[model samples]
Target: MSGGDEQDGPKHEEEGKREQVTVVVLGDLGHSPRMNYHALSLSREGYEVNLVGYTGSKPQIEVLNDEHITLRYMRPPPNLSSLPRLIAFFVKVLWQAFFLFFTLLTGPCNKALLLQNPPGVPAMPVCWLYCFLTRTRFLVDWHNYGYSILALSLRKSHPLVYIYRMIERTFGRLAHGGLCVTKAMKIDLQQNWGITKVTVLYDRPAERFHPLTLEEKHNFLLKLSSQYPCFSSDSPDKTAFTERYADGRLALCEDRPALLVSSTSWTEDEDFSILFHALQDYENVRHQFPDHYPPLIVVVTGKGPLKVHYTSLVADRQWSHVVLLTPWMTAEDYPKLLASADLGVCLHFSSSGLDLPMKVVDMFGSGLPVAAIYYPALPELVKHNENGLIFKTKEELANLLQDWFRGFPQETEIKETYYDFYKNIDEFRKLQWHSCWTCNALPLFSYGKQKHAKE
Candidate 1:
């Protein structure tokens, strides 16, 4: 062969190697923000990413907009409600294993597989087998222990829970590398599961979450008012978020309602009743001290199973001082709404008590002070009296709410502590999602890659 032919052969061989990574989550891609962040960060690092997950709510625009990332959807198996629950669960797992294995088998240039564990019933074993067969690297992103989550509904001593823990512990140790949500989880993995190759990649808000400008907040409120009129004032004229100036410039509405935001899946983990009781106490406080507290527009966003149950309860209430608005919104608008809010509340009780809440991280990123329900691992993220407050009981939360918005827009000596949240959050937001992921997560994913392969 001529010199040109020799050169062409080496180039062709080089091009044949696949340096790409497939990031998998068995849940809704849109709702799984951490995996989505991993995909985006990998893309930014100049690696091709194939994001695999169930098709549900449309993923955020960032994923769709990126050229380097492609979304591969897997349809979840339908549970036959007619069949016994055990038989149906068996059918579902079998289907998931088949689909997941083949999905990875056909993926182009799958140099590594990064999995989100929780629905680890079949995903863990299936992914480990795939990695074993293909000589591909397997990495588990431990959001929480799958068996621990299962134990939430099932008894800890249930036969199935024991089996799940055995399976998770077995394949979990086979992972080439791992990323967990906290140091506590990392230690747990090492001691119990024998998975020592772990990195703590705490959740951070995506760049989309930040404090919105005055004009941006007004515009967002105007758009939101069209759907949820709770955002509009009682008058026919102005929105609850802003008022007009003579020169056509808009300012926040005078005596504007304080916006408090919280989101929930209405699952077994987060007890929404605490928030409900807190609202009741808040109403009594307003009745007792009429003019002292600002009228609160608490917008609880997100669609979930128990939403209707709570909606019915809200309708039965006779709350005058506080208005509760539950609006299901698109992912695109969530951050904007978060950024516009004055305070955020979290009632998430971790099933394992080792993982931190992503909502609190997003709240901090949006520069909103939070009143989070206390948990064992909460202090890792929320520093009491610093960036946010931690409370145990509904009464404590109500008192916190009363103190946070003590004097409306007017500043009070007690509310002066609120400004410190802005400073602390600014320091916190300095380590954005990309930086955090790159620092702790990237190296693990970069493991076992061929240096000779094209990036």
Candidate 2:
């Protein structure tokens, strides 16, 4: 779906016209939060943003009611019966890239083309060619290295893997500027690939995510139970699961149940098994403390190829305490659910060691302390026992849960610690969002420099 105020020909510097930026992502727009943020932020900042992406269902032509932004979606290709699966995948990618190239080339010349990487193999080269031909500024936002993720399925020594790596590095260098999600990734790109114009842009959650009031929490819980009958209080073990106090106290409060929320993409890179095993361990450990309430565990995930397999595993295990909600939620309900949660768990281990998870950022925005699975790049965001807890093993995760459930003698002190951490995160998020465009992208691209100069 693509329709917007199209220029009759190539747009020139007409007086009082806003600069145009075409933000392209080969992935689904609904799933790509970083690209969504980019398009929204640019549109908010007085730039005309044409967001190009793929939509599985209906195309979303407008987002956030911003007139300056237009979303253009490409429907995925049908399955090919003759060619090998891998070859078929590339064929689809090539077809999509060709369409994207023509779409951008005909729209407006001399505008910035901001592309999201990972699917970079098909997108970067096409974007680079467009930029080269039209004198457009091509910039890449590296969420993760596409080659490293592909290497997870194919051996690094494979010819396809080697070609993917070469394409990424070559096109990445040719781009005018690049933005990465982590400092480690920035360092890697600078030292290994010699991409000097890269900058680190940490992910930030939308402003809607924040701590909910008690009434709001209750309303959200009611809505959740009504939407998903499995979470209703009519369940047999209703009395066993009561809401624990939110002020760092494990004591059962009223009818409200302690909420444990997790958002995952349900991919191979994310080790959900660790979370499942840890939940099992916590179940056994919780029995030891009868006075404590059994928390409600909600694992929110999008439907993927492994969804059925994981759902079957959960059913087979009969984790009565846990609820696995599949598919995506509406924008309004998602943050409401997130903000109402007592704690958030992140199980993403980056396919590339340098990448970070955006789910954690969203959790933090809601003032929810997280228990994140440790990865090489995680420490930069999650400070162990400070803003949040980080664990490398299932045992450690169980122990953390045990501590959370086992009320401390100095409950007030513990609450203070959490409050201090929340304050730190709030301050950090403010600073990050305030300087997001200026510090991260501005000095690298020519248009960014012009914007900065105007400011």
Candidate 3:
């Protein structure tokens, strides 16, 4: 063999070997699906991944099964809610910075540190420092601007908000590379945050999310019926989605209650009061025109700060035909629950006005059309009269809800509209999360690792 060929063979082979990348998130590991997808993609691309985060919810099957991925749980900071708001925040951040830095300080992540933003206080600063000291590549995934979210609670001119923005711009410029969820974020990152290496990696559904078959739907609904009796048919022996004939045949029920599911984070950006008022309006229509609107089962999922507040607010209202259910589900059941529903509602009003909601992406993957509250970047995911409907006010949202269920499993223009969305969403389901990450995210990690090895 020639001298150069012989010299490079071992180097190339070693470079392709399973190197390690550490992924950090300041939020719950199970809640941050994007970062988990990053770890999974990194594992498939011949990298050993250490997924470091706080513990709470259960992660999905693929992540739990991947041998190359290791989860490192951080000791959560003690709840200091008794302290003043500002004091509590700073104390929590200090504790996180100390713990997170030590976790990475002794980790096997010699190649790169990939982390999410918007709990930007401790994670961004800590991960950046870890990469800087080790000469490892630093990659930030921009889900949204931390400062813009901060502005939601505090005014834009607040000193803390100003300081946080400066910190982001500083480390943002120091990073070796980065990825963001939206093109608008890409442009803004380059313009304001000094992150020249920003790549727009739009959110896609994971592999497990898809339109469930009738059998799958029937099974899932039956499983769900154990807790929520409404999922059972009037017979009490069959699920709401299925019917059994005396002739020994089983089929999908013709007049099933319409199922709608929404994922809410209960943040300032998601105005749930609108959802509440709209549900009341739908209840009125259902009560007044019982023959037309049929019974409705609306399920809301996810954990958040304002969940208790809204739950109690909606509890006092008694509705004869409409029901609101708030249930906590495991990771495995979440995808199935999305697919089992006839429609999905999204209430995220992006804090930055430049990011799309990941929940909507999940809904599309499940082949359920969405009726999302309007925001600037929402059109990127939800198209009016196309795959989904978008609304700005309570009246419009209520109208959409009533119209979508005006006919009880019968011939109506609204049913045809839903049919068109189903067709369009089937086409939308063609792309999955791993495919997008392979094309957009893998190279950045691999190139940095190889370059580091070569040097």
Candidate 4:
């Protein structure tokens, strides 16, 4: 998952020649595609990439070891098992801060690249002060602008919301450059914090993910169909791939109503329970719309602990309309899985705007329409009925699904505007150099984006 072209590496060094540049990246790593991709790419580009992150239960040493990247993991203390979540958060902040200080004191100490994480609210003051004192170049990679998500999560007047806003503003003011996940996010920054000259680098799909060959597609489908017999019409696995789609394939049936769910992290928050229940309601009234029955299928992918938070819902209700898959399949399988789906679902209860999620790009990349529940920064990529749909309620969502099923949803054709923004990652790599800033003679890229600020 991590090798790059050997020629991409830094130039050969003569004896006693000091390292050209040292770039330290602190980013969220637990199930993070951005951090992993950025770290690997930066290292390949000849920078001494030092990445500090958390890799969940199974560490990702292979990536670091292969790319010649230095990794500092924030493994939780064994004794803190009882209070792992809170304790881990504290430890991670301390660890990152410690290293930030360490690098500043001993290493080349020229530029610092930071990915937003918790304690950002607290870390901003210290970071601003650190750069002010040391004169080190401070570049804030506003991967997901922290305040925007917090503001959405906590209504405006809440005390914590106010505190988060303060921190976000301060960080924006202090940062030499800002990076946002989407165009909308950049616009938000300009209007809110007055931070211009921002760069937009999307969460591009990894190099490992590419178009599948015809033979590869056949083998992929055969294995997937065999593994989940439900996908096979001849075999009675009770998963009802037909209900997921009448013809049972993305390309087979045109205008067939379908639902696609892309989950990167296994969490109960996406509210598939509500979605399932709503689908059941549709099933109950199938007789009314015999000619207009829209098939509903839910496809899920990603590796992690096997979990169905809505176990009770699945056992009691008929998920015969649902198709469930695991994290094992190759990324190539995703486009095919989604190609058949007419509507893609990206719903989350968490207010973390820091990530717009890679699945969003996959949905667009597959050319399938999307239905999102107003996840921050997502609107930047998905602009209501232009590319896909965005809804905020059970009734609104159900109605939207029903309408899409009935083939009367707003847009005549799904727009691929955002997809153009991510067509080739080479563009981003090029932009990185274009946006690079000189700090103590080191060329550092400040990935910043701009947008009209929203209060």
TM per candidate: 0.92, 0.86, 0.92, 0.67
lDDT score for residue 106 of model 1 = 84
- RMSD, one per candidate, in order: 5.4, 5.4, 5.2, 8.0
For each predicted model, how many residue pairs clash, with residues at least 3 apart or on different chains?
0, 1, 0, 15
Candidate 2 vs. true structure, TM-score: 0.86
lDDT of predicted model 2: 0.73
**Global lDDT scores for all candidate models:** 0.84, 0.73, 0.83, 0.53
Candidate 2, superposed: residue stretches over 4 Å from native: 1-15, 57-64, 228-252, 319-328, 408-416, 432-434, 444-455
lDDT of 3 by residue, 1-455 (tens): 01111221332336566677899898899889999889877876667789999998766667887777888988899989899999998999899999999999877856888889977887888998889889889988989889899999999999989988888888888888889988888888878766789888988898788888876877788888888988876675478777667775668777788888998888767888888998999888888888898788999997789999998877788777787899987767889999988778899998889989999999898888899999787787788998999999989999998888788666443566677888888878887777888788877877864578899
List candidate 4 stretches off by more than 4 Å.
1-3, 7-30, 57-68, 77-111, 117-135, 145-164, 194-197, 208-214, 233-259, 264-274, 285-295, 301-309, 319-342, 349-357, 375-379, 403-455
Better of 1 and 4 by lDDT: 1
Over the stretch 229-322, how does candidate 2's per-residue lDDT look in tens digits?
A: 7556664223223343446333333434456778776778777777777777766655666455454556465555666777788788775555
Model 1, position 66, has a per-residue lDDT of 74
Evaluation by TM-score, superior candidate among 1 and 4: 1
How displaced is residue 353 in candidate 1, in Å? Answer: 0.3
lDDT of 4 at 207: 37
